[model samples]
Target: MFMFKNLKSDLPASIVVFFVALPLCLGIALASGAPLFSGLIAGIIGGIIVGGLSGSRVGVSGPAAGLAAIVLTAIGSLGGYENFLVAVVLGGIIQLVFGFLKAGIIGYYFPSSVIKGMLTGIGIIIILKQIPHFFGYDAEPEGADSFIEASGENTFSAIFNIFDNIAVGPTVVGLISLGILLLWSNVLVKKGKFFEVIQGPLVAVAVGIIFYVVTQTNDALAISPAHLVSVPVPDSFDSFLGQFSFPNFSAITNPAIWVTAFTIALVASLETLLCVEATDKLDPEKSVTPTNRELLAQGTGNIISGLIGGLPITQVIVRSSANIQSNAKTKMSAILHGFLLLISVILIPTLLNKIPLSVLAAILLIVGYKLAKPALFAKMYKLGWKQSIPFFVTVAGIVFTDLLVGIGLGLAVGIVVILLKSYQNSHFLHIEDNSNGKHKIKMSLAEEVTFFNKGAILKELDSLPRDTYLEFDVTKTRYLDYDIIEILEDFAFKAKERNIDIKLISKRGIVENPDSFIEFFKLRPKSKISLS
Candidate 1:
């Protein structure tokens, strides 16, 4: 009786996400300095556990690109891989606490412009990071720490090194696999019914294995099994079961591990929160993900992943976007992808080894392009200066700094821009209230009205009609520049001269003689506070 009614609709999405996730999982592990198998384990847990419990319909979870830096640092700091595992387990506990405390609300504080900037910035990073891997560079880390480090010494330099001493076998296999993958996605799936039934990533992975096997027979192909995913195959069921590492409970008492735990929890939660927000925008159905529920799901997944020798996982936006673009219909597609991962590792271990890192790089490159295309820049620019300036600043900041820092920089700029715009338009100092017989004079402060607003204040006061009751409102103001506050205090003295009754209402309060807004807030010297 059980059946997937939307199987057809979900098929394409599953295939696309499957392809997108495969290399990301392996690359993240390689960058993290962990055994490649651990990445797959995280992928499985991310898809099955997190996917099942998520409020999101399309987002696919896995080890994140952003976490690669943290993972590398953590593995080194903890002294050993085993020690790092202990930190991960503890991290899960911290994430659970975050969910309980409703920390997901942190996503709301970010401005929309900043969020778009983050996406564009990350897209550029992905493309930059993958260039070396696509060119067959293996000596350096896949995701380097800084942009300058990428080449001449790191992954990019390693890519240059590969040109003269290119491993012919791996290079050939990688190129062939990449060709097949591209063809499958852009051609075969579109033209052939039989091929359409099969996922492009699954086929490409399959072809990669077959090529490896053919090359292995003659020893003519330079490619070796070591270059591929080196998943430890167990000879028996017990050995296979024994391969998973458990968390060291004794390490919980160590202060260093606890610190590591807290770091992981915070970073993972922030990434997950961002992913949830970004993914909702990509979903065609426009399903909004419940932030708190998503946190709980991510927390549970990380707890399990950490206990099982896996890297920390997050709801990744790229994978989620792939799922959306792929036409994923429900959560079932996500769960199926997890099962596919589980089966691939177990039954077809030999096949997975053939997947050339280059092929996966190509897939990610395409995804990166979609996220940070030139058209996106043009489109954002057309949205007006309010959107374009923030977006551009965010992109530039991220390129120069890191993700969070870049977003912060963009947000700061956006706030300042908004304040300036408001200030330029804040010439009005009063309005009329037809019903109250009281002249409701609404005064708006400039984006940054320091003592300079006193000139405007003097002008408005001089023009006040005789016997008028005035309501001086500054609620829409951003920064009540200190000068303006001083002017307000001075204006209190002239209200009687103007024959006007002045009522001040703002984020601060009615100032009889407000010295400084910041000083008022700090002093908490209450006068009269009213809200509309």
Candidate 2:
């Protein structure tokens, strides 16, 4: 398989992605109000299972922060986490059904401007959300992505709180780690393959650990346990095995359970498809991921995860971006990262827990900067308002609200832009001739006209001057809406009252003063119009 072909690049990239996914898995679990271990379980399954099955070359899958609110509320409404597991299982089955239905084509509908906006927005959120952790403030939960945090402090407020809460130790370590990353990426990598293969994130984590160890005795400089990674340590093999949760199969009969399952399937599928689109765009090779296959892979992963008491999984942009930025060559990087997480938890939980969170924050900061650079903003703006409006709106919405809300806002704006453009292009109106004091005006219908063009067509028809010659051209038209045909028929009668002579022309036939527009054109049943 191609899995091992690029080990030099993929292995190092996997290490970097592992570091990123570890904390996020736990943080998203915390945000979801589930046992922290559940997130890790999802991460492991997502990487090993979904990564292997997925057609995406660069995407990374895991417990998603976007689903935290849904999981938290669902747990409560469903009466318990066990009941929620049943929904999770059912959701996976529904996703499998969706895959069979080939529902993944929905990803193509998203505008490029909105997709770019999503990447930039997530990047900004990473930078904004990590600032507090970089400064050593740990009040907010790790995986929380919303602007109004669970700690009752908004994103900006948390940054302002840094003025009072900033600690000496974590900040120092964070700065050093950030410097190492920058030096490695900017200078050292240019020298040799040794620097390239070693990876900066791994070195940064090592330094952070050393800093923690060396400062343990110095009260003023020691990194506190609260500001470090926290992986659950099991007492023994049996205890570790006990951590796995099973679904309450009897709850399958509950109507509420079905609703939750459908909701999860729909949301998770949409998120995965959107991430697939975004990930493909970010790929330097411009490789396209098979969207339908991705849904099947995700479905299989969630089913397995739920069987073992894990949270729902989706393709996460943060870890995927990190994987790409780290120069991963294939899906091997994603699969290996999952194995790393599993090994770390089982063999070296204590060592894993010792790594400082601030170091991880520093790494994420670089990832964020690359996505939302100043030059990108200028580039999008130069493309003009049409492209920039959705881009900026999406960025602002994600910063001010949340991921889905921001995308929704951008998508709404994108749709409006399409409608306005469509309205303008419905038809072309021009004066063909003006002789004998009567303007010979020709109104050519566009290639396709729907009810959306009704208003413009009606207005132009009613405004025609008396005693004018009107040439209604459909020679170039292919599909015409029944609504427009009705409007034409009505206008034909109105033209007579205004003393307007009419000439109707089309590829089908030509008629002078045609009695019926629909009869003359013989509009096809379903092919000619869309309902309206």
Clashes per model (N, Cα, C within 3 A): 7, 0
lDDT of prediction 1: 0.71
Off by over 4 Å in 1: 1-3, 141-196, 206-227, 422-486, 494-524
All candidates: TM-score: 0.78, 0.96
lDDT of each: 0.71, 0.90
In model 2, the Cα lDDT at residue 498 comes to 92
lDDT of 2 by residue, 1-532 (tens): 6679899999999999999999989988887889999999999999999999999999999998888888989999998999999999899999999999999999999999999999999999899989999989977775435563556777788888999999999999999999999999999999998999999999999999999999999999999999999999999999999988899998889999999999999989998998999999999989999899999999999999999999999999999999999999899999999999999999999999999999999999999998888899999999998899999999999888888899999999999888888888899999867867789999898988887888888889999999998888888787677888888889888888898988898776668888888778767544464212
Writing each residue's lDDT as its tens digit, candidate 1 over 1-532 gives: 1217878757666766766676667667877778777888899999889999988888889887567777778778877777888888778888888888988899877777778888888788777766666656655444422343422355345545666656666666566666776787778877877776666655655666676667776665745544565455678888778767777777667798889888888888887887777777767788888898888898889889988888998888777876776678888778778888888778876666666665566666666776788998889989999889989999888777676677778889988886666545555655767435756565655444444445655677677776677666667655554455545556666666665676666765676534344455442332322222
Strongest candidate by lDDT: 2
Position 136, candidate 2: lDDT: 93
